[model samples]
Target: MTLPHVHIIGTGLLGTSLGLALRRAEYPVTLSDQSPTAVRLAADMGAGTAAEPSTADIVVVATPPDVAARTIVAALDTWPEATVTDVASVKTAVLAEARTLTGDPVLARYIGCHPMAGREKSGAIAARDDLFLARPWVVCSDEDTPADRLAAVVALAEATGAAVVHLDPEFHDSAVARVSHAPQVLASLMAGRLKDMPADGVALAGQGLRDVTRIAASDPGLWTQILAGNAAEVRAVLADVRADLDALIGALDLEPGALATIAGLFAAGNEGHDRIPGKHGQAPARYSSVTVFIDDTPGALARLFTDVGELGVNVEDIRIDHATGIKLGSVDISVIPSAQVTLTEGLAARGWWVPEAAIDTEGRE
Candidate 1:
């Protein structure tokens, strides 16, 4: 198949990454941005060349939520022959705006899309060609949207190695409000509590706290725009979360049945957490961890990995716990339940200290 000539506007992370991914797939890609420096940087990074007057087969508007509708309309106007799509997180507002801005003919060529992939960092510099690999790319379409235009949008997502999912614009907006927007708000809120803490209290931070606050470091300006654009849906999700928060607070007051409410809340959290798919969209598999003591010297991890590779044991995940005031650390290697015995025996035979009962057969600790 002859790949589409893709024209990407907005040289931020998603735009630049899309350009690079399309270019890597042997498609002709052209990039443009309101910021000349951004376009230049993305072009220099091999994302794509500077935009020129040419017929684009597909026009991708990767602008922020606030400007997505306008950019999509402008792209459709400029490239009348091309199928247009936007990578805006919020879709309902943009789709509604596009419906009002253009007649049925022009609107038929446009599809609203949101690629569920990103980093805490922003800008063209942080863009990666493989950003969309194995990620969910939601495509919002309507009755007025043409079949070929929808196919073109799906092709763009699939060409970049994303898994495409079809959704209505309203559902797309509501779904992201629950999954993406709510998480960002919660992460930021949790991180904010640490702002006034003592240094010692902050120093005690562990992996759990780090995991919770990681997305909190994202660009506030971008999030502010997203939250504002999806205010209605996001507010709905936040209201529910606030109610849960109130319940938890009330539980802490030790009123009658409060303890049971707290327990129910925790149980609900576990159930929800377990529902999240494991690696590669598969059912969550339980992995067993095998902890081994290793020196803190260089090549220690490499040696362990090499040994495991030789044993044909695939490590699912790993964590290192540095021993305080010591040169040795504990390495916890998580593997599928079936590999637990083989890995434990092999490491012990290789003269590695495998502590008895070191395998955490129960789910993640």
Candidate 2:
């Protein structure tokens, strides 16, 4: 099949990553950005050559949410024959603005898209060719969007190894506000509390704290644009979160039935967490975690994995917990419940330390 030549505007992380993915698949890719240095850096990093004054089969506007509509309209005007799409996180406002900025024909060729993939970091330097692998890429199409243009956008998404889902612009905006935007805001708020803490207090942090606040390291300028663009939807979700916070705070004051209310909140949180899909979009499955102690030295992890491979046991997930002030670490390997006994026996017989009491199906030691 003949692949479309992809012209990407805005050489930030998403745009550069798209260029690299397309180029890896042997599709012709051209890259351009308002920042001359960014475009040059992206090209040097094997994303694509600097875009020349030429036509393309598809134009991808991977700009921030604030400028997405303007960039999409401009791309449609510049590449009249190409299907234009934008990878902004928000959709409804961009689509609405694009409609006001251009006529029917131009609007017909433009599709709004959002790739549910990114790191906490930003810019071309952080772009990875496989950034979209196994990630959800939302294609938002209105009734006016041309069928062929929509298909072109889907094909582009697939080329980057993304699972494509079609959604209306309004629904896409609201859904992301709940899942993506709200979480970012919460993470930032939590991390903000650490700013005034003593160094000794911060030193006591662990994996749980790291996981919760990881996205707080994201680019604030970019997030400001994203949060602003989806303000209504984000605000709606935040209001619910705020109400829950108020309830918890009130409970802390020892109101009547306060303990029950707090316990109910915890229970609800656990249920919500379990509802999140696991690998391959499957329903969450219970896995048994096998904790193995290892020396903090090179090749220790490799040997463990090799032993697990030899035993024909697939490791679903792995977490390493390094003992503070000790030359030891614990490797927690998650496997199917049925394989727990066999894996434990196999590793123990191989002279590896497998604590008999550490094999738990509940994923805790």
TM-score of each: 0.94, 0.94
lDDT of 1 by residue, 1-365 (tens): 78778889999999999989988988889989999999999999999999764699888899888888888898889888988888999888887888788887888888888999999788999999999999999998878887877887898899999999999988988988988899999999999999999999998998899999989998899899999989999999999989999999989999999999999999999888888777758887678888889999999889888888989999888888897798999898889888988988898888887786445654756
Tell me how many clashing residue pairs each candidate has.
Answer: 0, 0
Off by over 4 Å in 2: 357-365
The C-alpha local distance difference test score for the whole of candidate 2 amounts to 0.88
lDDT tens readout by residue for model 2, 67-137: 88988888888888989888889888898888899887768888878899988788999999999998999
Cα lDDT listed for each candidate: 0.88, 0.88
- Displacement of the residue 260 alpha carbon in candidate 1, Å: 0.7
